[model samples]
Target chain A: GLAAPAIAQENPKISWRLTSSFPKSLDTIYGGAEDIAKHLEAATDGNFTIQPFAAGEIVPGLQAVDAVTANTVEMAHTCSYYFWGKDPTYAIGTAIPFGLNGRLQNSWFYQGNGNTLMNEFYATQGIYGLPAGNTGAQMGGWFRKEINTVDDLKGLKMRIAGMAGKIVEKLGVIPQQIAGGDIYPALEKGAIDAAEFVGPYDDQKLGFEKVAKYYYYPGWWEGGPVVHAFINLEKWNSLPKHYQAALTDACAFANTNMMARYDMKNPQALKQLVANGAELRPFSQEILEACYAAALSVYEEISASNATFKKIYDDQLAFKKDAYLWMQLSEYTFDTFMMIQQRAGKL
Target chain B: GLAAPAIAQENPKISWRLTSSFPKSLDTIYGGAEDIAKHLEAATDGNFTIQPFAAGEIVPGLQAVDAVTANTVEMAHTCSYYFWGKDPTYAIGTAIPFGLNGRLQNSWFYQGNGNTLMNEFYATQGIYGLPAGNTGAQMGGWFRKEINTVDDLKGLKMRIAGMAGKIVEKLGVIPQQIAGGDIYPALEKGAIDAAEFVGPYDDQKLGFEKVAKYYYYPGWWEGGPVVHAFINLEKWNSLPKHYQAALTDACAFANTNMMARYDMKNPQALKQLVANGAELRPFSQEILEACYAAALSVYEEISASNATFKKIYDDQLAFKKDAYLWMQLSEYTFDTFMMIQQRAGKL
Candidate 1:
């Protein structure tokens, strides 16, 4: 009884495969990929479905971007920094040591030159990236012993790899790359002295508290790490304009959702870890200052060699310098006031 | 040549109208409504379109929700607290004095029980609410003179209303209810000693810096205040499943986009405000403490009378208590360190 519109009548049915860099067990990060798939299906009435495969199902977690680039998969959900060894510019896509926090990173990407600059680098690599998720500010990993000074970080073999590894190495830290599943055992068996994963919710799942007593605050290295949705450039170009818009909106939704879930879940997970005798510790000023200096040096070294990294990093630093000024004035003051009330049991 | 699917073939063409409570000049907040319309139109290939009307175009700013309820429009982009006079529960849907920040509020809504609890209250008012925008933490306000202590607040005439008015009234301040367009003239003419607006980005547009030299921060009452996409419950229920999903995702995208734009824009605006002889000031600890105590007393009084307000507020406070604990440990420490570097000009 109705005449079908040209757009609807010509709508093409398509299905694609997505590989996630995380296992289904860590639902917060991996679930972001699933959310994109779910929203696309519901928005298009199951016309555009994406089947998700966990790490190792199609390729190893660290190899997700490689799969996307090779066209082995149409898309990948991963953290860009995992392939930093190939190019330091990859690290800026996710995070950098002493880089922008989650909110600031999102601001830089969407409002500043982040999307354009980062995508320029990605396009060269035959990929297109969209920020799909974030893990707020992570912790400084679980330590078998308290890290009191710069001396404590010396010779500490930690499970950290990436731009953070390079920065820490300057502070006498021996960085080790360990798989997600192997972190707990490595810490327990003394094969590794400490490990840093995502925040409390995911870290608790990894059983880090069972082996390490001192849980540190402020993972200065990772800060606000972004997880990205990477799509093959050729495949991305072939998508209809409507599908592109739908996926963009869906990824943005997932980006916000992942952070919300972490914020909601981290509190309880942290409380549980504390009850299990996980000693919470703040990295002392001596250590923080030293690492901050070291981080700057590492940035200088990379910027000298990599022009692409330098361009994006320079833009991020400029934005960050001003962002923190405004942040410290408003949200900082408000939060500090509320925190005092909470400590006083007045809230 | 193609067999049309049942869903695609039955997709009905729809056009809806949205009224915003913000003026066209305040693009950050008002633009959020425009983004939703833009995304919806592009995603649905013009099958679904939403026309947005600025404040006073279709109805008065404060009457947006009413217009939606009366079916004058299908939806509205407005703050819930504007209708707090109708029911105190409305305030919780947007923000409250000393409540959750934007990130925490989003966490509560999407991951915690916020959406269900808030919608329950909205449903009672014949409305359905979705978080459409956030203006991170806001500046406290612009003041003609510095407020260095609680005593300085006594007998002060300020343009504030609703819950904050009640709390500040307990501190011997006379709260004035002035319209947006009237605020500039009031501050300039010494008719009001102080006024508060969104933040630096939107506040600069109001030209408060020219008259009120002392700008204070941590707008405690509106910390992370939310702007909602409110729909008539009857109209909302009639939407097709796919349309509902599209709207929901579209709103989330706008929510993130609005905050990103504000975060990116506020820094430059703040610098300009400072360059214009705007003296930045902080509310002293003594003043914050007194206000905190007065705010609690106000909440208690309202809780004694308003069950709906108490139900939603109690849940929020519980979430806020845990949220700050984790937030202070992670982002707080990180931001504090960065602020120190910025102050030292090391950045």
Candidate 2:
């Protein structure tokens, strides 16, 4: 409900410049940013136009935050967690290993106090954050071999993103942060033993199935990964009320679009991946348990060190516990039955 | 892909009866079923194991086509349009007239599609269709709503549904058809106003949202309407899968769960809708003209056909096409622009 005066009447035409963290090669994720530009112009009757720049065009993909904060650019669309290097607390805004799924995240944002908490986090960075898109529960990552036990993780060099890398590091594995475009080459040349991109559709598009034979599940790192639109705080405050509303509404629309595209596209992609000899494997209980423990330890460490991280983490963890309890009783039971029946050939 | 064989796993020591068009809601749409039942059972784990019944359970809502085709059953969860009737098709679906708003229909179906489609329709014969759920989009009953200059509709009574009864029939007006439970009522009601049901969502839900809504674009007939699950397709194919997939999937999941559940839960529902809605509602003055002409001609007929109906006809028709197209293009362009901006926004 933050309303500002109209920048100009008669549907003034204004062009904006935007920077993205993804490459054009990854259409869906990259396409999300592209879509926003398209819709904004159309919505404004071509009165407002925006020009998009891919990663590295304006700055390194990972350095988008620095650019936006420094006002090198007016806006940016990227994951908030990528900058956890600066502040571990930033990871919670994008995702946390084994954290809330997309639906729950939305609830946390729109219904729960997530947006307010996240906006506060962004204020410190001199930017305004809006969840523009989300990739609902991601696949663990592409692995060259099956992860049958916790021992397999030892010494494994993996290209992973966000806080999950911290958890994996606890298992004695080396976690490398690589940009999306660079992951394939890194995994292909043995620079990394594994890499986690997204679900089947995106993973397949990235051609990971070609190089990685054992695809693992239960993406312990990113349950629901949210992409954010980082607008310069000063610029954001300068927008007219309707324009802001328009931007907000458009972001919400884009967020929903990205998830749906994935859902509809992933099923077919998974089918194709299996047909192509991409083996889907579940992480063994040992590895799962080890990761869980490591994640907890990391959480404890962050909480003890960063007060801001602890504040959000504490509330998030509590909410997660309650949500899980509710889900276990209802969602789990029904899903278990259906999955059983599906496996049984009864469905 | 992970097709594990069913082991003779011990079943949980609990039993409960859960009804649905689907066996068990698994993902989003069905997820609700799973969530609701699972929560209920988990809240009482050992004390309760809900037995799920799919469509055709105890009855075939479809054959409310035949049984109500023959005089059967009790209780059914279905869309009204499924029984386009002993008369015109209008009685079977909801939308028609400017059609009830989605939020409003939720009110009407949980309250209206039940009474009008079931009570009024079924009371005449011996059957009932309850509005256990709704999917939303309804095609303008394959518009034969030839509205040219608005004066054309002199004696037409197309098969329209819900509140549309008041608007369309004003020109001339003749409404008919019974519930999916009693579609025979008004078709048995008389010539009738044009009717309409859902698109793929409920068309598949009732198997007609598609067929009837086929005039396609501008589903002007139904911007988005709800669907009901009719019962008595000879006691719903004698229980089992009948009530399992169809009822559970359709009513419990698809119908009730597809739209809003998707709108609320799925991150991309609206985006997909806009993308798809655009493909569906292309701007065409001619097509719009034809539909307007048909609508008007039919209206005139109804107005002349019945004096009581003609009283309210003028204002209703006046509002029918008034801002429909302007809004469509304006909103479409704005939305399209925003989508573009979003994509580029991240760049």
Candidate 3:
């Protein structure tokens, strides 16, 4: 009687729909959206469920944010920077040129006030965000020839993302914003001289090695890029407390899973890219110096015009300072030794 | 032309000390290690070089795995799984028993793993580990907990870890294996019910967790757990291959850096426990029967003893497969409806 009585009192079922900015081709990033849905359903014992849609399946790829804002979809998985055209502050939610790398960004979000600050910014845009995934620190871009000096950047056409494009623009280079699926065709046809994506793993999958022979180091633009789950504010609030907690927990899991998958897959891909004649080159000193200078100028310009951006930026920069200091003593010292050995073949 | 040749031949006086398992901690796992060290040193010019060290450290944590492993005395930061014994795994890693709640575990590791794992697993033995971080899964210690009637496990003192001791063993408990630091106190106090450390994370931290928990699981033993770094391995091999590749790329960036740390940390620690609380627990019909007949036998034990653990587990149980299938339909369905509704709450 006790078992039957308890069984009869079941929780009500709830369902959800999620749209993703990535195509299934980028499994890890796109896969994060899918994972969130599954965990939500399972955790709630099927009482709650979510459905996912890929970029362009239900709406245009670039329109994810607008759609969520307009209530066209209940939720969307996307990088906040894509909507920077609406507000530059959104860029901080995703990445910034030479900003915090993935781990630090995560610290900023969960431990520091990053999540809270970014969410406040998102609120102004009519959405809320959960850090769903990250691409760690990224590579600069794939180039057709080695970048030997600052002059190499002038007149070059590059497919970069968000605010980095603005910074690069100041350096006399032309910047283009294109989706992941379109990068290869453009590179192959010479429509764009360069393109930047998450590190070796995803870049290889997109077949950048075939079209670009010189892969440069350090994606200064997106030191640590975060992908977000943009949820409709009103809807998010309506969910039962348990469902909300479940979604948050699932997103955390998805975020970590994405990083691990990338770590495992990138090494082999990098080795393969090199074997395919992709020459890995460091960014020229002059060019790096120029970009660093330009990045500072852009930061000043944004700070001058955007109050919200300045608030988050100021705090983030401060945290980065402390994190860097601590790392210098531990992470930095240890890593330096290893790189030298790797180059020397003693490793 | 003459000026160019001199500049080219200058070959910047660059050097670094990296502590890692892989050459670099890029690709997310190791990439982070490589990127930070390389970026920092480069950013500051050759004045700052980082040397990396791999898993065995300069030698090996089992050999001498910590900062001592690489000899980069400036500092060594990493997980606690690499040094299982000298103490119990619980001291260094956090996968033991019901353990601290997940969030609590994070605090414990950052705040607790530092002292506990180090003092119990490393310090007393002349090595050291830090709570550089976590990965987070961790199911209830795989249990042979008998439940057909609940009385079957009486006096079944099993190896368990952390707090899970009191909960499960409560049903007629006999917990044991507290971690290196905690173990002496607990075993001496006879407070344990049963215990578990981690598959590898806390395992090397030591199998003492295994002493009483009887080490049962679906790993189910560890759904997902944090790993650690154990330093010593001849003070991590007498340093200076960039302090042994910055201590082998900071233990290959804590090897996963957390996972690899756990991997390296678990072996030697487990080896040390041959005579201690090392009995494996078998799920009794009463316990298995009460849990799930399908649950008990369906746990992929066939894969437990062979190459299948390596191969089939990822494809079949690693979250990707089921998550993929379920998200495809359910998440898609729910998100579509929710997105269309403008009033949903945002994250």
Candidate 4:
């Protein structure tokens, strides 16, 4: 039993700054940090305060991870996959091709080996991590033309990141690694034939429907994409365990809030997108099957070279196998029946 | 902009007690309160500690609601549906037949009107509620015989709870409300032919598979049963705002943990049960269809009698329609495709 030590009444006020990978234009994603700050301050009697800065305010969005690692900033909220360029393992922290969904991702993190594994990896980066938010499953991307077969993906220039880009390269697609702020202009200028940002809510705000009429279903590359807070490892440990718990609890609250906000906002934004002439289409079976094959090969190749990656990836793979099997019999069965009934106007 | 006033340095020591409906033997369910207490103590710098007691230790499991209302204890963790006998609206706080899954339940409670509506109703009971834990979707129950049609349910005696009993009654099934400790014995003795508790993890612990060979899945009545912490309203109001926030954040942490723990545990528990000769089965389509129709009518009748039930039910029903629509197009599609590919050994 871990008995509590006696309470010591003395307290010290502290202030910290958080750098976010998101620009203010995407309120739901960026506001996750603000949610953490607000709750932390409220929880601590205002004894602690954290101010959040948008991308480029303190450092470029992609560089927030480095900023936190360098101890130049106290904390940051960003998509971990953004740093996969430094190490492929980072992508698994956020999302991977045909990876866990939002629900499964949380199960992995809080319940399985994910929390400890990711934290250990972050420790090597001189950072400590807490999940702040997830975008659920994202739309594949917005394309100028509908994709009908695997051939439609060949030679297609698309703006994407992380392992998804690497796997798509095998499909003969040219992968363009564009930053968040520049993706819109890149797509509009036809520099990239397609781009995958988040789902309907964020995509609508970026006006993707105006430039591309074909909006695809399921971003296989980034289902349940987690956005997390990266804290300087030394700084995190320096805080009292009490403060650590407060920060972690606040992060959990923010995690649930982000997904809920997106679920609420996306349905309406999607309707508006359709009304504004966006075409909703599921990825053709041929394309999905091809990508699934490419993804498996890519995973195997990467795991061969990276021991750390192999360890974490293998753990998730087993968890995913069992989880999907159970979900198929339970969640998927009910959902399928209900959906069919709904379509028939019986529900 | 709600700016922090100023950091106050003084704090007071506090101690509280939490009674849980779960027994200590069921670590996954019972551990949810421990998680909350652990986080709360750490967040409050050990200035606050909450000691947890299992059911029957303080008050009998089902009496937790009344105990909290009467301030027999400062707080209690239990299934809200356990109190549906007090008010049918209580069942909605936890789950309803064909209601939201865990993911959607969180969205409804935190992001939709559920929080406000549930809190408002709790106010009348002199209580304050916070969602502290959730057991994702549950298995229907363990039955001694397979159910092939609605006729199979005719005159069947089963131990179930919430409004599920009322709906089952419509199909000529006899529903029995059995206590946690007595359910296994009753089932073993053929006093009850079927029993639904939680998922594989807890059910296996109770040795249900030894007595019942047929294990059915997708408990429609409990897609995502949320177990909450009920605090005496007067005690909650008396806490400093800082402490209140600490408690709320801690509850959020536990909410994520409960589902994750169950997800991580149930897969193995289920596999073990199956190896032990427990046959896995899905409810027949005829039976599900009949239950669906009965559930709808039961809901209507209850709402017609209880305005409180109507208000909350209407809000959730609207939310469910929109949520399901979006999920069908996005989440369900991806899951269905991915699951099929995985089963074909392609994913």
Candidate 5:
């Protein structure tokens, strides 16, 4: 901000509105829109400014995409998976069970033709999906009791969102779909045995660690979940090239900034959670393996029946294979080895 | 490119020149500047354009920062660590031995105070450093013969660059500082026993694989080296606000795009290298541990005598420790588990 240029814009003034899936309380997610607006305004010297409305202030969060498509709003920031009701292909737009991580997802989206393919799908719905933010990776959730095996999942009333809800149901777990604002109380009052939210940063704010002493990680459900800035194609097309560039480029900025902020903030939050009597845990290998198998069948069934899902699933599966190989050799190997050394007190 | 904005800009024309640290032959490294120039020109509808000059045209790649500082060129694209001879603090600006990986490095630079700190340092030299591109995790290097033990390093000659050259030297290896163009022949003619020039993309172009069959990985030295676009502070301050915004935002765009491009391209390149007789190898744990120790001590020695290096080194070390903890818990754990299941033919 200190280095901002001083020249004023000669273009026409413009104002727009952005509806967000997240409430104002979760700054990290909701702030994505605010950041974009800041950059746009700064670049244009206040010639353009966007006002962001939290979920339900205009249209409900889940209906954000529809609102944009209907021209009810100029733009919206929300996870694409929230619209799986429209089509299961939406799930892969955000995150998929046992799918790509943050870096791999970005690699595919920005470089591996994912942006083109997904946007092709979104175009049919009258929307353009600009990847605006990511939540690096989410924690599995806070559980009141530890889950030791696959059998521990039976009849468990757990609050999960999007596609993860459907996948977990196959393991005899009763999926409880609860709104973000309502999830904490449900878990606190024992209405739900467990709950999954963004991560330690947001989960700590929601006070999940207070009631659920057992904190588990590697959110198989939402590995590197991304939020899309859904813009109406008509509205987007009407904007000036420079303005469009500003918005598009700012979305990418928000995307990188969101992950960076989370990466910096989460470690501190995790430490606090552990210090607050919350026990850190990883899902047992048996449980993870079972869920992995269950997830595959669930995906297979959906892809077999849904043409849209089938198309994306096919593309993603192929891409995921290459990503897995490359990341295993580069990213995973580096982190794994470093972790061993760090844990071994060498670093 | 398919989704380019349709509107054209109405801005006045302006032009600038950029000196790059990489030669035209190494597209991956040199392309960072080109990508930035392309985005800026596109955003401004050709009203603003930056002409990128290959190394040795205006000045050698290593002197790029000096060219920018001296206003010999309007801008330059180069890795900051290439100037380690000027000051050890330069290493943290790009990459350090056992420093951050791609995502974590970006997180530190953009999200943390790294941008402000590094820019503050650059300002002292009358320049502005823009975070433009990253190469992700680079390969360890190509060697004519396999290295299995610490004893193999004794009296061995390797063409390594940056701070890594010094760290390896501490382990009794005679470091051979050769130009990129000279590295291949140096190894081929036995002037150097081993050589490294980047990962598969450029290394393949340099014909390292054909001459040296052993390709080692994790790079250990340059985990996620980032390229900085350096602008003369006076020239930058004189640009129009929107033009400044275009350049700054485009740099971020190029940063994301470069890494994404490398991530997508490296997998295929590695595969092809292997098919063409490159025997992939991981540095043995013994060598890695030894280099890591040597790196830490080298850093300590530098930080002990250099105030600037001490400041950034302390900050980076503290940040890396927490990053290690957080990554181990989330990023590492997820990738490791998924890779296991993936390699086991599960999912």
Candidate 6:
């Protein structure tokens, strides 16, 4: 056995409450908080413990940032875009329509100036944000009827989240902001003509395929949306250095784990959904192009109005250009070749 | 301030040495070890320190695993495939020709049965492995002349790494195993017809563009190669649980950060390489297809003889099919659309 150091003896035992924006039922997303707690506890050997609470336990899911801001909890694990109603800048912390994919988002945050830029915005909100989870390039959503063209989106009532709602509204769609739990009920009752949650794994859990027969390919709005652990600024600044270090490492671990879990689980779930009679379809190029135009227009409008949104969004736009260029040249080419082999059943 | 818990006082003060299979100049790859040491030290309040030595300090780069096995160093950071000479199964720990990309590799390791399977193989060698770094989808080697077809490869001498040499050898090419530092001189003096290193950033540092005018896309042999920390199994088993957790978290953090760093750095480096007279080219479809056939043939021969290789390789092949299928459906479509927009200058 090794001897204890002076600093080790000074290590504090701290208990923090982490309220998640997701319900316990959505394990992959909600599990980020659980992973953080479990790993931190194990690393500290009970010296530091983080207690995780599900949505509606301490406060509603969407109100997670508020609870953290009010210091009702030390931190909250939730999607940053969920709080975009407070400021459009919040959406950039997670994703913007037609923005970065999963790999790019992490690259932007960790290597590019993303963490510095977003945290500068977050500091004003009395929160310090650490990306803890991501659902990679989400499915377009479940449509009660096939959406074959831009005309199909007209007057469509869709349960879309965050800034995407604003973009799609430009495409003649009526966007509704419904909580994850309420989305299925709204879709089933015909209150929403379409709905988009995460990808196959989480979407399957909600059983959306039963009510909406056409499941779309890509969710343009929330590509690689990040789930963050937002800690109160005051609480974060007050932490002992080691505790803060542990928290950061814990979040990083959970961030990587969540994406891997989704990638691993989504394939089997999608296969199951198709076998059970769900129709998988890609959104037409016309609809995608229209959505792309709408997303750009929306960004231009916001960029002109809000400097904070403009600063971060502009930086992200620059990074995204180079990122996709590199991705297409290498990752895209390799994956395409492999997919062809897979289709030929030669893999 | 929070109070120290009883368990906190039990935290031990320990120091270990880590040998790395990379030069200190290759910061992104070598940086993984530094990141782990820095994070672990900070988190443990300097109670635990891991001193890292660059390659040749403790042992030569290829001798990393040997150092760890013999307990010359508590741990060593290296590419698992570098030891493929000992056993072919080692290649899968880093990459196999036309195997999983970075995302799929992480997904397979973390969520699929990758860690359990790989570690089982490592146990036979008296080591424990943890993924600490990755260079995402490396660029094909820098060639003095463009490779246009299958005929271009015949009688060519290339400095390639690991099991890739075995695959390329079947293409009627002679493969030389040269160290990173030696490759630049080897390529410059026409000692090797072509030489492959990492992507743009690392390749640029070695001045490969100076000697080789043609830079190729998508290193088919190493789509996503992982760098792992190989710890002596005996040392790993004896660690206090908290220390183990800290080490795991540190490696996980480094693993994620390494890929992000490459993604962020490669684009600008690529631009510089092009501006400096390096002609960028894609490996012709004929070459790719031919090499793909040769790789499969080599795998069959090995699989027929090696049960361990066959078992792990078969499982990976199965997971690869479903992973790529899901990837093409969502990630591919989204990235492709974004790439098209990029080319049109609409991004």
Rank the candidate models, highest TM-score first: 1, 6, 4, 5, 3, 2
List the candidate 3 regions with Cα displacement exceeding 4 Å.
A1-10, A340-347, B1-83, B86-347
Which candidate would rank higher by TM-score, 1 or 4?
1
Instruction: Evaluate model 5: give its lDDT.
Output: 0.84
Stretches of candidate 1 off by over 4 Å are A1-9, B1-9
Candidate 3 lDDT, B110-179, residue by residue in tens: 3222344334434444554433344433322423332235675677665653333444444555666543
lDDT tens readout by residue for model 4, B125-244: 999999999988888998988889888899999998779999999998899988877988898999989999888888888899989889997788888889999999999998988999
List the candidates ranked by lDDT, beginning with the highest.
Answer: 1, 6, 4, 5, 3, 2
> Please, what are the lDDT tens digits per residue for candidate 6 over residues A1-347?
23235545466668899999888999999889999999899887778899999999999887899999999999999989888889999999999999999988999999999999999999999999999998899999999999888888899999886788888898899998787778888988999999988899988988898999899988888778888999999999988888788889999999999999999999999999998878989988898899999899999999999999999999999999898878887777888888888888878
TM match of model 4 to true structure: 0.96
* Fnat: each model in turn: 0.76, 0.00, 0.00, 0.60, 0.50, 0.78
Candidate that scores best on DockQ: 1
Chain B TM (all candidates)? 0.97, 0.43, 0.35, 0.95, 0.93, 0.96
lDDT (Cα, 0-100) at A40 in candidate 1: 86
What's every prediction's RMSD, in angstroms?
1.8, 23.6, 24.6, 3.6, 4.7, 2.6
- Which wins on lDDT, candidate 5 or candidate 6? 6
lDDT against the true structure, per candidate, is 0.90, 0.54, 0.55, 0.88, 0.84, 0.90
Q: In candidate 6, list every pair of residues with a backbone clash.
A: A140-A218
lDDT (Cα, tens digit) per residue for candidate 5, span B18-115:
99988888887788899888878766657789999999998988899899889999999999998888888878889998888899888898877788
Query: What iRMS does model 4 reach?
Result: 4.2
Error of 5 at A29 (Å): 1.2
Candidate 4 local lDDT, A33-71, one digit each (tens):
999999999998888889999999999988999999998
Which segments of model 5 are wrong by more than 4 Å? A1-10, B1-12, B345-347
Per-residue lDDT over B280-329 for candidate 6, one digit per residue giving the tens place of the 0 to 100 score: 88898888888899999989999999999999999999899899889988
Can you list each candidate's DockQ?
0.72, 0.02, 0.02, 0.48, 0.42, 0.63
Task: Rate residue A190 of model 5 by lDDT.
Answer: 95
Worst-scoring 10-residue span by lDDT in model 2 chain B: B2-11
